[model samples]
Target: MSTVEASAAASPQTGLRVRVQKLGTALSNMVMPNIGAFIAWGLITALFIKAGWLQGIFPALRDPDGWVAKLGGWGAYDGAGIVGPMITYLLPILIGYTGGRMIHGNRGAVVGAIATIGVVTGADVPMFMGAMIMGPLGGWAMKKLDALWDGKIRPGFEMLVDNFSAGILGMILAIFGFFGIGPIVSSFTRAAGNAVDFLVNNDLLPLTSILIEPAKVLFLNNAINHGVLTPLGTTQALETGKSILFLLEANPGPGLGILLAYMAFGRGIARASAPGAAIIQFFGGIHEIYFPYVLMKPKLIIAAILGGMTGVFVNVLFGSGLRAPAAPGSIIAVYAQTASGSFLGVTLSVFGAAAVSFAVAALLLKTDRATDEPDLAAATAEMEAMKGKKSSVASALVGAGRGGTISTIVFACDAGMGSSAMGASVLRRKIQKAGFGDVTVTNSAISNLSDTYDLVVSHRDLTARARQKTPSAAHVSVEDFMGSPRYDEIVEQLKQANADSTPAPAAPATEDAPVGDADVLPVSAIVLNGTGSTAAQAIDEAGALLVAAGAVEPSYVGAMHEREGSVSTYMGNGLAIPHGTNEAKTAIRRTGISFVRYPQPIDWNGKPAEFVVGIAGAGNDHMALLTRIAHVFLDKDRVAQLRAATTAEEIQAVLNAGE
Candidate 1:
């Protein structure tokens, strides 16, 4: 989540901070997801450009004397011929598409792209910053015109009006971008470039990290990369064959160091997931993955700043630079982009930054693991909850009780394309399968959320921002986009509500009876007053119950442990639903759920758990059962009754009541 979304509830005095964060989120949203394109462009520029390793491999490439030179010259020729035009032509359109989509979806994207070409054509320098500004402005204008025309245009003239209006508006913006905005933006770019050049000449480049690290933590990495560094780096690379400006903000050393520290000293989910995150950060070139870790501990920004400064200082001392921008900020990409003589220097700078950051983070984490455990657990819970379910059927029912019916559902995130898009697609599929074909599902950036959506689903981290953006829309939060069990509960609720209001005819009974009392969860699976002090112990006892009932193999218990290691199974309200990982599917004999109640609450990571439910399913067949179980636990009355039950028979009766 962006700092703007995280600080939605901040005081009025922090308005500047909020605005800065919003700008960061918008700019980053435009560039981060498209890092792949940047990386591809970077590789092309680094491998085939005149100053690249191709010339080093074939020294005769620069000589105009022989046929060998002709073959070797192809690299530089292709680099300038193909890669240069890509940056000049395609980069602006990409920026425009992203910015326009953030404001008004596909229609806005079209107008934004059209308008951006005018700026790109008119300017000598790359018009990236101009695209960022004009793209959204054009999209917003189109959105306004669209809203104005809604319900007003005659049915037969709809296409005619839309086509004419869009064409006229686009043409006008293109002209304005060329004659009006282009000159002003170009002048500013020239001034900024001169200023940056002066800073680099004076050897004060490392000091820029004071601003860059904080802005990066707030999701301004993309804006800094494309809007500032890429333009400057391109100019420098053209003149000197390489530029240190590219590495200034794209370094992954600091983030990698912080993750390593977490792996060593952090508790709970942070420790467990840090190793995998480290590998992705260093190899995948995705620096955004570590933003949440920094956000969870804002004070850690100091470590990032110090580490970034150290890396820059080393680069300056070694006179190291890259042939092109290192997209995704991965170490491998950095090496790939490094100039021939700068490889050792760049490598040293990277590891140097990592070492500094690790030291600072380790000191902050300290030796007292117990003292930090609770905070780590809370952070882990918050992170997981962002991908977990946000709303219950009871809450949705309350909203529906007020005469509301969900006609539209919008999945929102910091950027529209990442998790929200995936979640929206998955939910749309499920909604269609559940027969709610009339309900429209879409995805958008959190900033673009509007009251038109009847339901807004987003990460829990963005719930406050979502509510602020679309107060009338019912909100749902989830941690994982692809595997949220909450979608099933939501579908069932909507189906039931639709059935109640539509007066549909009763359908014939089907063989699949929704996994209720008739199918599984007999009294034998219930264990009351179970003996367990820790979450793992409680889960083990529950899994044993499932194993004894022939619901799963003993390997299923290890799978449960493995899943918990990745993310806590704690479902809030003193309940935990432990299940095996996907890899453990072979251990399942059938779909079954076993419940064990611990009279004494056990610490499920940082959350307290009094009830442990072990789940084993052959496939997705248990999803319905999981949904029913969620509903049962979500109800205060049902949970209270289950807690008060004395015997396995009484627990069974409560479970049956929930069904």
Candidate 2:
């Protein structure tokens, strides 16, 4: 289970925290994709602005008549430069388009851009906050309005109706954005900028490290930096030419100090791993490389807090700040974005933070050496658990991989009722087909896991928790339970292991099992050259096919969207299996599956999906044919044929060919 999942099971407050984190994740998603644009603007500011590098190198460039001054948007040239317009117009529009695309699709993106322009024109300040609001609003409003006339539009008039409806909605949203949202967000932005200035003026800004250091260890660094700090910092930078807000979470010193301390005072695997980790943490700017070291000695968080405070204090004393956010917290990135005269201050801040954290961490490590020694493996596991995904750098610290003969394999998930059950059914069939009768496969919730199993397979997000439960078992993590490539790897490993031993008898062949009132998937349900304007539209098409086959009610289609809203159904390898949520089981009239192959991939939650499989399973009735379909997809050559197929019959034949 993930930290969010575990927390929700514990208390309501933690559940609320999870919801807040989700919101942060959503906000971060909007900004992360646009970081490149921010970088471009920063580069321009550092190189061409009035107080920039070129002016320092050649003083004449600072004059109003100089070409450099004209390019820099300074002196008599005013706001004519690319730097001002890019941040004011280009960046926010990109963010708005991305946000709208996330909410709906291409149409939503177009409407979102239109609405964002209104806010841009209305607000004096850069309207980043306004774009974040209006973009999604435009997409959502368009979606709701379209639903009213869905299926009610006549055939040939579809294009006419869609174009006019979208144009009208965009115009209305744009007007609302200009008059209402622009001013509201502008006020919010100014207030936030004022708060940061107050913190800086009072010399109390370093205190923020107390919350920041702890949050970074918990894997909320990206959220805090990109979602909250970047937007606020951008506004501050516009007014003052630099912003200290960007350095708070992006400082690499605190993490570097902890790793250096581990190298000097730590023992065993942690000591051996610390040197390489230090390089990655400091130079590569992957701050996560040192999180396990802190997790091993949680008191080291104090070291981090103190180090952060020291760095902030040094920067404040020097009145130094970055022109833009230095992503990945790398020293190289930090230097790249530093203001023209702030090099000394930035350098000292890193060294000071490193010195403080290293001293504190060394003291903790040396004193605790006798009594604790700190279990590196256990701490690494805890770090991965907190991160909600495996950390390759942390894994290297423990040297965790081991090889042995496997007899029993277990599949685990949070509830073990949905994903785990399906995964277990699929893997069991593979093992049986391989004639490995001695190998026993089962499914269980992570809470019920036992250490007795020889192997445990789980989703990557849940693997850390499963490891805690079954520490002795060799673990394999996968993303998709339906058709993971890992399952095939496991089969291959098992086959190789028994190469020198007596061969087990092959299982007898049986006719493919029946599913629902008809076959698992019928020919008429398979659509070649499948058309969908968006992910949601694609899902609706698949659901419509299922409904046509009498396998599910229309309500099941809505349930599929509900499920997607909570957790995306995107499986890897260009395939996405759209299914109703567990609660929507009643919507299933009988077991059924529908296949739609898109010649051109549609964006399924930012991932390209060429194949969409809509599934409505009634009990275990569909597992057999589902397994066969999964295997067909597992084969790259078969998938290639399906992708190239011209007719629905060709696609159907390719799917059944594996059987």
Candidate 3:
């Protein structure tokens, strides 16, 4: 759900695009984890090559001395240097092992590395493409082969069988890779290399920004940079000591320019927030900070594209390039990776791109006086819609206030391995520092949440599911795992509660309270016997009640569909809560709830929903109502009672009984 996009849900080519995005994500996953190795190799190459900085700094290194030539790897010495062996064997095997591990764990990793060595020795050039193929292929094959004899293997012989089977399969794959895959991948790499050559030779490389800039805003920057460009650029760097391709997607200039323009010419929240966003974008090398700005005014994309072109053109004119990929695309990283004699060109490229983008963005913002200043929160929601995940830093732009203290907190995500882990770590530090060390903060997959925590934090898109998993826990929805203003709010809430002589356990009510301590769901908003054929229709039926209650605009209904398309709002236990995408908060006039009980279960994306609760919460106000709904749904007896209830008052009693 976090990986699926709202805009993508509406696109006719959603399947193809999602598949492509998945492929890109997979490829980046293979490379991003091993970036440190790439950087190490790049540093070695930059300093030890024939015309490298080491030789320029220490002239004796340039001589054909045995040790010098052997270490430098460019002279007549016949020995392998640190640079060549690392690029040729170490990096490929590491990548192969990582890809395998991603699929089948340690066993897959071992087999993948074994198979990759065959391609590494078989090919004249680096075997990155071959490693990408063989690693996953080996893992998949092992998984299938294991499945064949899974239960049949004798208990005593299980280890022996697994070890032998893995070794034998790895041997076969290695042989196959040597004889079959090496030449095919080599030829393909060559063809791709030729295409890059053609573009660089014809001065057409800069034109790639037309695709790059737009794709970046869509959150495909990692795929384009690490998956496609980095490998190609590494190959070029091997031959020429640097590659211009590294700068294509990693350039921060365009994003920085847009932020600077917002700082100078933008209005309202965007203007107030631009300076900090600019700092993060330009210096921190987080290009995502500016994406919301672009989403707010799509015309800014034209500026980004043109700015990217300008940077690329300048780099091309000066034949400027980096020795390696700049991981964060920060100006400092870019400068650190700049090739020898390219300082001027690299500086010019960044400044040139910024200047062009700033100029264009300024003109657009100045001329667009008829429209009111954009809502940073709406733009952030739009950004999340396209990105298919919450952008944590972007959430700070909203500056939303918070309340409540919590003793137990759980950071929940789909897998609970990546983002949730990070969020837990971040919040743990804050809690310890706040002297609330006794407070417990942990992370778990939404599915693995067997026990109730006092507070549950999750992505806004996944809040419904989190509530379903732990109905008693107060839920806080956030966009990012790395950083969120909500963390500070939580800390402050605890401090205030302690000041008021309230224990941490007594703060759930404060955290759960909306604007006022009253019921948000009234009898009028509850509708029984709703009729809808599909999930969209069910969502519409539910959303219409909120509209009629003056809770939201009619446009909010469409957003509910879009939100459903991106991530199923299906909470388990025959309940479906249809809510607008976070960006659709602008459509809400006030907090309201609508409950529609379907006589027959509605097909909600493959899940059957007997009850659809449409929600339009204006702030943290909606969270309290959701917590109440979660509690009722968690009780099988109460759920059964509500299903059989004939009167609206009966349903209300079931929901609001204990609360």
Candidate 4:
């Protein structure tokens, strides 16, 4: 059965931490996806600015009377003038767009951009920090206004009202930004600059990591880099040709070290996934890839902190500094940004920080293995669950929710397809079967979630995000789309809610036999300590046992194979439910289930499975038994108990207990 990772419950003590993390994540979401823009800007600044590398490459470019003078003029004008405006104007607009989109969709984004223009124009420096703050706030206000006046507006005047309200709100916010927030922010920026100069003068640059590491993990790297560090570094670089401030948080070493540790010591899916993530992070300069890992185990923050401090210390000791910010935090970018005579120091800092982080992470992973193992296992199960779309009616019934019924349900995910599409199809079928034919079920990208849906379903990892997008809708979090028991619970609640008005459908003739009947799992059909190296082999073994008991025709095995080809039968938690399609109905001599337990897990598609249940039925005959089986698997410890059972009778007892 699929296991869910519930949303983390919040408490008063962690409130500050939670808020900081949320802010950081929001800022990161805005900036990280737009790394290409940052890269282009960084490259332009590095090559074309007054002290840029390009000037050194062709000395004639610096001579006004030389042939290359026009080239130098073009580079200088574009880099200093064009690039700064891009960051000043376009960056805030982009950030505003993302922040507004998060809260109130496209309309909010447009308003947010308009408001941000006020801040951008009011400040001498790029108004990224202001954009980050005002964009979402503006979007939120607009969203509330829209909701308050939702149906009050006349049908023919919706466009007029919406356009007027958004324009008015944007104008008000822009005026406030220019007149009020602008001067205050400018004063604060000056004060912050003074403080950084004090720290650098005292050689206390390493101390910045105390705040930087934690902030970076929260997704505030962009805000910190662009809002504070970049401006400070640019000033220092212009005067001294380099600034150590740029390397403080942009070093990829610490995150790379953490990922390497996970690749080496992490359990199950964590270990399996870390290697690929490490490559993307270390080479692609996408440090955001490691943020989730740090979030998963917050104590790892200590490792990042120490590593960052150590790297900064080394840079300070060697008088090492970068000429510009290293976009993407890749090692290559770091080296490219390094000034003359600083390569050795910068290289040493990277390795030293990585070593420190790896050592600490190794200890943490080892110490927390007991607790972390289950989460890793669950992640593995979730991965397997994403591969298929077949869900048994019985499994569907037991997995239903006890929540309030809704006429419209939307399945949301990061992307609109993949698991959400399959989940929508599964739930749609279950709803129809439960006599809720009039209810609408749909799938959508989480960003496109509408308030019109009565209920929204998403993966647990995305529950908070889904709520952020559609706060008005009831939300259900599921771990595995195909194997979630929540579906059964939801179906049950929906069925009851509509019972008075909607007529129940007649049961299929094949479901006449009760789920608990002894014939469903007769002792002769149970195989303990079974030997099979793959899912197909194990499934065939189970089918053989069923055939021996006169439960199915020999042709049923091929039918099961055909069904497996369409979609995996693996239901996760080391379990695979193998059954034939409706076309295989002629092969069923009797409706029964054959349970086979492998002594060791077998490869089922790319997933591992220890149990294979071969099912044969005429119409919906075996659905009741399948529901009971689903219940059995829902128990967290049931799979372990079944795996320990050495006898067919013991397995039989476990199956009966669920009934």
Candidate 5:
């Protein structure tokens, strides 16, 4: 059980580290369940397209045009239609829940949700694993995370909920191949073919036009039946428009072998919605998805960029005029009314997409191949392997930790106090060996010990005289000498005492605090600190602090757009809480506190909000900081105290001691 006796943590500095480890475990858990769904996602389609004919069980399946086989005119895929949703929406719940329960006991649910986000996001829509599962899982995880630490936990389900909106876009994209966006596009295709039917009956438009369409299918669809939406022998063999059906029948634009290649292979997202990019590019029409990747990893994206251009260029050269929409609004669709070479135009379109994508992917995809890192095809397999081992190990460790006195513990030193801090780190390792999961152990000079720390344990020099006056109520003293026999006995005794305690205060029933808190603290504390030589710099310092504390990765500041390239987090009212992401997994982390007074006010946004507050946290922790800080931001007295904090110590006293 977890409990917070008071707001007795030593300082925010120690809390950050524990958060990182917890989230890492969460990442491991989520990846497991999606492994199976992803592999099967690809396989489900294969049975219909790859099989020579409809087998015994598949023959009973419905078709894409008929949801029930009886609703013949409907545009949805009847047979394998639900298969896609099942893969994306339902599988993660089952896998995450089962995996969670089996591994971390109460916390397993939370861990499952944490890891599931990554797993589902790792795959395209077909193996998506909805936020219905992801949201609940994240909430459940946060709850468990709180249970592991003190009662001060935060709820963070909104991220996953927001993530689910993409599913709507995914469904629309899937249907584009079959529906043609309404009857208007269909009429357009027919109008052009009407006179041609006349020519065909009269012996004018060559039967070779049939070859032209097939050629377009080959190139424009950028059909990598090899990767996504492949042929299931069942659907393909059944001749039921449902198998290999998406390949030729479902038209997302006139087939930009270029866009298709990127949809199937390109893997860079400037931000939200990488999987949806395919639909936007292929049908909605934006080829920028290819560019983000090209920019992020030039060597990697080059081949695919060239491949896309090649496929598009070739299609235009061929005169393949698809009456349907072409992404980035290709020449095929634009030229549908243009004249004689429509057949050639269609051929060129297909070839263009295929050539560009293939070339670009081949050139950019520089895997040692021998390293056997299943970049695309075997990605799920690697995840499956993690499910079988690393997840189990991490969970077992976390479970044991939960069963002990500290479910979430932190290790700290100066700078959190480096040497004794190093000692705390060593003890942290021993505790880990004993199977403590998310315990936080930190090291900081005795002066800054008030705002965080459920209980404080320190070596010789870090005594009661130096620390007790600062903050942290629960202090356990030990000698600085690590090798001394007495210190060992004292540690063992504490371990036993903790193990022996009768009904240690049960974790408060209220559960983990929310991840996002827009309101909490009655007053705000602003700090200026970072590596940049200029005191005037105004990036998201809290986010940077979180990264340094091991609470979050450095990528979080960028992900949050807190550091929108040169933009300072100083909201300008002399206030800012730049934040970061713990997107990876749930773990306890130290919250670093510092006070900085710039010699001159830098140009933050035009608002002039510069009394900055920066925060770093797991995916769900920002709200707590936000809410607490917001209250502070509202206080004029607190702002004066923050402005007066000359030394880090003075800042600590004013911000934490008074609060």
Candidate 6:
């Protein structure tokens, strides 16, 4: 039987293994993201707050009742203590994106959104602003803002930028903060929070409460203590509550609900989380324990409500002494004396409520793992980031584009025929919208895409081709044909690289090695798409020309084909260089430099190619010509530039950047 079938056949309690595996994977993904040490940062900050530590750092947010306490909360939490957390808010976005990838493949928007909510509200609201309200809204926007490359260049640039922006720069920020920048950053955060509060307190009271309250409770409350305030940790905290179960430390409503419900669905393993939550609330006074269990399945909102109503009923029926509102966490927080039937009565009420929640969860839900997809962590992070902000995957991809490297693109779906084409079109449109200038976007099957695009975006099973064919191109998978923010991000990267790649003026042409007739040779450039030809054949045709010209040396001609098979040195863009370097000097000489059209296409790199120019240079300083040649094919005006040049002189003129 298949692994999944066996999983189904095993007792529900058997899920403990899966749960442990998943938790391990989740923990691994949380910390081992393109982002740095995210899970460790989260757990650190969690310990800080759970321990009620850091009172020495900010005296105002400290617990007033216990002035000397060194653990738990800053001296002046809430609005006054809101500084350090907000700037790091993007971390939770990363977590949500990663988690979504973990659970649902590319269909991560919804849970990513929910995860965002969990992070934003897992804090002390009175001290911090609520950020969770943005989660669902962000998810909605991501769904609608889908963008694809669609054979366009601009979208690729955007994809490179948006997705990679934080990962690349966030590291820099982390370094800066580690080197004492964060301590000073508080001034800015304080000012920003004050401004937000001023606007809300004076003009939009109710609306502000709705927006800021939950976020403060979930995210910023003791964020610094919880480590979510760190650049990487905050990114994790933003998308998922690595520590929201805090208030639940005192409140039984939401905490007990998920625990009992788990017993119904995956009974045996559920106890791992459920019992842990119960014990923490009973004596540990830690509230964050319940968050992981509840946030595991967002549909647990029903359990939360059921637990809340039951807690309220038992409180009234037993006339339990309202002991400090029980930390809004569990009946365990209540004393045995002033309550209904003492501590025993409270446990009964708690179990009674738990039973109801378990029944609802077991009879109504089915548990399954998320789909398999590439870059799951990054996807989940972006999806989570989109939850509470105006950002979308498309926009974020565009934003991260500036840092991306050149990547080939492939559009893949079921037959490599229709959906691929559709995706290419959407991607192109989004790229145009992002304002990237003149980017190339196209579509072809994985079988035929041997050298065309660098990154393959597809939904189809190209496993055979992926393993057997070229592996340089990174494979990206998506479910819908609508769009991907990543394509635009790549376009942005291309733009930056182009802007940065102004070729240095031709290396003083070496007198040691000379073009026989700088004035007489005819130079031609050929451009081809969706065609394939073998490297060996192209070289053979070129060798025939050199042989006909009597210009080719035997040693030079033999080494050409040998090196071609080793690396295929034909970096495309309507160009191919198949030259073996001199033992000392690496100048390409045997250009057999004419364009050859192949009747049958062959894999060039990983995509299809129809036109190619073989390059084989000899001598020490012949590199100037090669450099010029590389630049020629990189631009979009390849055909026009080549056509205008009737002779070598004209070609050289066009090759020089317009003076």
Of the candidates shown, which would achieve the greatest TM-score relative to the real structure? 2
The regions of model 1 sitting more than 4 angstroms off are: 1-10, 13-15, 63-80, 151-159, 220-223, 265-273, 288-299, 367-374, 381-659
Error (Å) of candidate 5 at residue 391 is 21
Clashing pairs in 1: 285-328, 386-478, 386-479, 387-478, 387-479, 387-480, 388-478, 388-479
lDDT of each: 0.71, 0.79, 0.77, 0.69, 0.37, 0.40
CA RMSD, predictions in order: 19.5, 11.4, 11.1, 19.7, 20.7, 21.8
Candidate 4 Cα misplacement greater than 4 A, ranges: 1-10, 64-80, 147-164, 210-246, 258-277, 286-303, 318-327, 333-345, 358-659
Higher-lDDT candidate among 1 and 4?
1
lDDT of 2 at 162: 95
lDDT by residue (tens digit), candidate 2, 1-659: 64323322443453444455566666677777888888889999888888889889988677886788777788778889878998899988988887787888988888888899889888988887888888888778878888999999988999999999989998988899899898888888888878888898899999999989998887776667766688888887887888888898899999999989988999887888899999988898888888888887789999999999999999999988999888768999999999988999999999999999999999998888466455566666556545545677767657544556677899887644345655776787787778887788888778788788887887655776887898777677766666666688778768866566555665654545532223667877888868895678888999999999888999999887766654456665788877886677888898888988887888665457899889887875665655566566667898889888887777767766634
Question: What does the lDDT read for residue 321 in candidate 4?
Answer: 84
Could you tell which candidate, 4 or 6, scores higher by TM-score?
4
Q: Name model 5 segments beyond 4 Å from true.
A: 1-35, 41-45, 48-129, 132-306, 309-354, 357-594, 597-659
Residues 385-450, candidate 5: write the lDDT tens digits: 212121221122112211245333333222232233334544544444443434545555454556
Consecutive 10-residue window with the lowest summed lDDT within model 3: 507-516
Alpha carbon RMSD to native, model 5: 20.7
Tens-place lDDT digits, model 3, residues 1-659 = 32234333443354455556667777778888998888888787778777678878898778875565677675676436777888889988988998888899999898998898888788877888888888888888888888999899877999999999999999999999898998888888788889988998999999999999998887777667766688788788888889899999988999999999999989888999999999988998888899989988999999999999999999999999998888888998898788888889999999999999999999998888657668566566556645555566887665432334456788886644334544665676666667777688887778889545777777666765776677555556665344466677667756765565433332232233332223466677788899787777788798888888778999989887766665566665778777876678899898887889988997654446799888787865565566556556657898999889998888877776673
TM-score of each: 0.55, 0.68, 0.66, 0.51, 0.26, 0.26
Indicate the worst ten consecutive residues by lDDT in candidate 6. Answer: 126-135
The candidate, 1 or 6, that scores higher on TM-score is 1
**Which runs in model 3 stand beyond 4 Å of their true positions?**
1-11, 396-400, 403-659
Provide the lowest-lDDT 10-residue window in model 4.
1-10
Candidate 4, overall lDDT? 0.69
Name the top lDDT candidate. Answer: 2
RMSD of 1: 19.5
